[model samples]
Target: MSDAVVGQVAVDQLLEVLDLKELGPFRFRGVSPRVGPQRVFGGQVAGQALVAAGRTVDPARLVHSLHGYFVRPGDPTEPIEYQVESIRDGRSFSVRRSVALQGGRTIFFMSASFHRQEEGLDHHAPVPPGVPAPDDVPTMADRLARYPDRAGIWAAIPRPIDVRYVGEPGWVAPGDRPPDPHQRVWMRIDGQLPDDPLLHACALTYASDLTLLDSVLSVHGEVWGPGGVVGASLDHALWFHRTFRADEWFLYDCWSPSASGARGLATGRMFTEEGRHVATAVQEGLLRRVGE
Candidate 1:
């Protein structure tokens, strides 16, 4: 199959996963991809939980911020049930808490707030200076070609996002990448999406998890898997500052602020290709060497 066709198929699958089955009011069900890791991807749970919360809210209100915790590893073979609590609703703001459960155990939970668009003070930080355009960076396929053995299971997974890295990725062999404080990349959905703003936001939520944690590893040129470090996201938070499309190019500029006690914290800012700062994300994860 052509690469474009494969990409579209992957994106369609992602959309299907995000489209949760509404069991009843404030309750929904989501399933993982048939072919994926043994543990569910954290981004999928966060995005699905957001979808559940969004469905119970007023469409006029756009999600402004979300804070989520990964309480336990999710099983990819089973379905997940999401319950959303309507925390509050006011003239201009609404809050919802979403909990994901499997086997009656809470695996993940998130608190998200939505805001009605209104005229108010507006400003955003400028995009980082002297960064290469998305088109100038090497594609994931291009990079993987140089490290075929390292590709491992990732090569079999469908890529719904077209990512172009500005610096070395976390999957690279140790010593291949020089220590760099900043980890930047340009990315966008691999296929076209409908014009629903909520879907766009959810898609960005999924894409956000892909690389934010890599900033922590890049600081010391550490890679994932054996002979390097293994990690799991403990918590994640995001703030949406402006409207943007998931299908268009955006820069994800990330850096690590600290790493201690076997935990690493990373912060990232998203800017449109046109230089509009649209979103920010922060995450801290448990990072430990193999067999530790």
Candidate 2:
């Protein structure tokens, strides 16, 4: 198929995968991990919630920051209701809050802020250390190919995006030694994105949730065993640093600060090729490691 055909198909596929819906004062939909787990992915919830908020905001302003908490596990088979509250509309910025409900209960909640582009003082922390150049690293697709016969989690990962691991260890199974808690990877959509900033931003939101919380799971030599150690995303937040294309290569450097009390925290930063920081993300997940 031609690129246009592929693009069109991708757009439709994303919409179908997200399955967004409109309800009074809210948007409703179902998001799947694509894994067999009965619960939805937290990043999917955050991204979908952003889409819900985006629908209510003006086009002139684009989302720059968001914070969300996943309060309950959402049934993958049931649709999630996203209730959007117009928090504030100002001359320069607007804010919206979204709550994802399932079974008449709040499963996820998010607050997002949008802003019109403006010139102002700009400074960001320098990119962290030890990220491999994109050319030298193996893409996740290449890595997954190493396990062609393996099924389940490997098969569940959606392939709309390309990911290159900077320092990936224990990706397939537990290693001889304990796995490291920190990792670095680069990612982007496999195809080009349109010039529309809104679509690009939404795509970024969709891609941001991938592999975020799993960085924590890698550290403890804990493999995401099939039907074992039930895990779910608990909360996610992201800050857009500047305008950037989601189709271009961006580094996703991830690390886990702590994991305790059945929860683990993972943080990630996205950077452009020239080392400019584009976004930052944080996620906390319920890591109920089976057999304690």
Candidate 3:
């Protein structure tokens, strides 16, 4: 009946979706929430595949990087099977490749590398100047609420991560404004998670895709809507630089360095509340308009 109650329920369901069921030693089963979509979200599959790969590895190794490709749109009506390959185990590093299958066809696959933490040379780029704190921003719901008629679709879906935009969301029309190539948002999981470092990495993987490519659209002043524009991620890569938790708010500063050949590239850096640069990501997507 209350908004808090409804919000809590949605988060509990998201956590359940993240917890994959192991069917065998090297295989896992994951399901997507039936959130009024014919296809499942790509981030969910990536995170699940990473989980499968991490499960096959020893706890001593933490995931430092993963590169994955989206092969096809996932069918939301069925469960996805993840098969992990243990590629190699070195003295200090391990490698694994995970494939997500449905109907006996591979829909997505990823290669992940893990490492045992060790002391080494340490330095990082500082947080960008004049970035507003996450607490001072408006929630997505509040922004969507401003456009009463167009808010229903976004309102009906359940969000596993809370994202606070530093400026206007790219989806909202910015009248008479020139195209901008930068996008910034603060994100955190909807609920608390376990102390597992691998889970944190997977959670960040899921969160990373939320708005990285939107920087591309922002540069063209294109907002996704009926007959407006369409886009899908082709490939994604992430490099973990330091330790961070998914439940705590992290600043994602992103920019579109280039967009040509009908493909746009966007990159992002993740910073912790204490200003530690924890991760970086780059994604290229097929961006085009409807009926083009």
Off by over 4 Å in 2: 1-12, 24-37, 148-151, 169-171, 176-178, 226-230
Please provide, for model 2 over 184-203, each residue's C-alpha lDDT reduced to its tens digit, 9 standing for 90 to 100: 77877777666767667777
Put the candidates in lDDT order, highest first.
Answer: 1, 3, 2
Worst 10 residues of 2 by lDDT: 1-10
TM-score of 1: 0.97
Model 1 whole-model lDDT (C-alpha atoms): 0.93
Model 3, residue 241: what's the lDDT?
95
The candidate, 1 or 3, that scores higher on lDDT is 1
lDDT of 1 by residue, 1-292 (tens): 1233247888999999999999998999999987778799999999999999999989999999999999999999999999999999999999999999999999999999999999989888789999999888998888878787776556777788898899998888997978999999999999999898899999999999999999999999999987899999999999999999999999999999999999999999999999999999999999999999
lDDT of 3 by residue, 72-169 (tens): 99898999999999999999999999999999999999999999999999999999889889889998777767654444345666776888988667
Residue 45, model 2: lDDT of 75
Q: Residue 221 in candidate 3 has what lDDT? A: 76
- Would you list the clashing residue pairs of candidate 1? none
Candidate 3 Cα RMSD after full superposition onto the native fold (Å): 2.1
TM-score of each: 0.97, 0.84, 0.94
Best by TM-score: 1
